[model samples]
Target: MAIDKEKIKQAIRLFLEGIGEDPDREGLKETPDRIARMWEEFDRQREFNFKLFEEFGDYNEMVIVKDIRFYSLCEHHLLPFFGKVHIAYIPDKVVCGLSKLVRTVKAFSLRPQVQERLTQQIADFLQEQLNPKGVAVVIEAEHLCMSMRGVMTPGHITVTSALRGIFLKDLRTREEFLKLIGKQGL
Candidate 1:
């Protein structure tokens, strides 16, 4: 769905007013509109373009996409959590295009999310979409909520992972996946 720019701008104006800023001031007049556009882009995760998943043929292998950068909001403090996501799936009959994996990560990581749930969601989606033999997802992130406010572990990275099917049942398969992602023996 397309974004309602005017409505988002009005919400931003209300936010500015609540924060004791004059939205009508010269410098602040365009702030609402700009913020609205930013939010529209940030919420792109709500929409999914399934057409991007249609390009894979019969190739069956462990498809791994690593170091995909993303930025998301923490649901608790509404602060930013920036991170890299690594995904690997052992395909069955259908395989997804390599770039589609990145798109999948972006599609979910663009909104309010928790690293743990986000990791699982990506793994689940790959399982559902491709019916893969197994799926693995890992995320490493630094949250502004934790670094700038709570606990304040500045520069400390939080990691989360989700493993399904063979990735969960077979230790060797899981270890191989971890090694491929360069997180083995950690």
Candidate 2:
């Protein structure tokens, strides 16, 4: 859905006032506009252009992209969570551009989301788009909600994974993916 910048601006203003801060203050004057712009950037991910390439030769092997860094807001708390995503796919008849993989991560991460669903959505999107032999996605994130409030435990990383097709059926395939991502286990 399209973001309403004006509504965001209004909401931010009210939020500032609710928190006992003057929205008209010198330092806070442009905060609402800045926040609205951030929402616009996040909403623009739906239009991301994807470039695809058909399979060449007999090159059907596990293609992996690791350490794709991303920042997202936790849906429950609206606090930030930063992470790295590791993706692996065995192509069937199509291959995707390397940068597109990074874009895909951003497309999902630029919204209020949980780490588990984010991992699954990336794997599912790749599976549907490429019709791959298999797709694997692993995400590890540190949630500010846990560190900055509530239980107040810092340095805890939550790891989530989604394995589809061959990766789900083959134990060795999953093991190799974990090893390549420098993890003995998730």
Candidate 3:
């Protein structure tokens, strides 16, 4: 669904007033418009436009794209959670361009999200799109909601992973994926 920019602007103005800040103040007058525009940017969907290719010389090994940086707003508190995502998939008979993995992470992460769900969504999308033998996605993020409030522990990162198919059933495969992503194997 399309986002309503006007409604967002109005809501931001109301939020500013509710927080006891004057919406018309010199510094704050444009804050509402800026916030609305930020959401609009997130609302625009960028096409993946990636095509899968047939097997290349009988090559069928794990393809990995790691350290893909992403920034997303938390669904719980609307706070920022910025992170890196690592994706790996064992193609069955087809493989797409490596950059497609990075694009997949970006496509799923630009929306309001939780790290756990974001991890799974990437894995699931890859599994469906590539029909891979397995898919693994790992995310490490620092949440402003946790760092700026509550326990207020800054610099603490939350790690989440999703494993599917062969990655779940094969210990060696899972271990290899974790090791390559700079995490110790279980």
Candidate 4:
């Protein structure tokens, strides 16, 4: 379902008013519309198609796309969590466009998600669609929930990774991937 921008604008107006800000003031007048536009764009994930993974055949080497940047809201605090995602797959009979992999990551990251589950979802989708020999996803993020609230640990980063098939079975292959992403570069 499409998000109603007008409804969000109304809510933003009420939010500003609730915070004792004058919504009609010049600086705040357009804030509601701007916020509505931002959220409308954020909710565009429902429009992506993941069938792009079906375009390649029987190629069995690891494919990796590293450091795709994304931003999302934390479900617990409803604040921003920005991060980078790295994805890899070993194709058995199908492969996807490099941009499609980025888009797939964006589709999920745009929603409120826990880092670990999001990593697994990306790996699982690629594994299911490509039936690859293996799939891997790594995500590193900084959550406002911790940095702006709670214990307020500013420099800490959270890392989550998911591995399937050969990546799960072979330590060397997993190590290679971890090294390539600069976890233990050699």
Say which candidate scores most in lDDT.
2
Residue-level lDDT tens digits of model 2 in 67-134: 99999999999999998999999988788899899999999999999999999999999998888889
State candidate 3's TM-score.
0.93
Q: Against the hidden true structure, what lDDT does model 3 obtain? A: 0.87
Model 3: colliding residue pairs: none
- lDDT of all predictions: 0.84, 0.92, 0.87, 0.84
Pull out the clashing pairs in model 2: none
Q: Which numbered prediction scores highest in TM-score against the true structure?
A: 2
Question: Across residues 1-186, which tens digit of lDDT does each residue of candidate 3 receive?
Answer: 777888988999999999999999999999988988877777664455868988562568998889999998899998999989988989888999988887887788888899999999988888999888999988999999999988898999999989999999999999999999889854
Q: Write the per-residue lDDT of candidate 4 for residues 90-113, one digit (tens) a residue.
A: 888777788888888887778778
Model 1 segments more than 4 A misplaced? 43-48, 51-58
Clash count, candidate 3: 0
Better of 2 and 3 by lDDT: 2
- Per-candidate TM-scores read 0.87, 0.97, 0.93, 0.88
Higher lDDT: candidate 1 or 2? Answer: 2
Predicted candidate 1 versus true structure: per-residue lDDT over 1-186, tens digit per residue? 677899988888998899999999999999988977887876675566554343464666688888999888898887999989989988776777777788888888877788888998888888888788999998999999989897977898999999999889999988988899899974
Stretches of candidate 2 off by over 4 Å are 55-57
- The positional error of residue 162 in candidate 2, measured at the CA in angstroms, is 0.3
Error of 4 at 107 (Å): 0.6
Better of 2 and 3 by TM-score: 2
Off by more than 4 A, model 3: 55-57
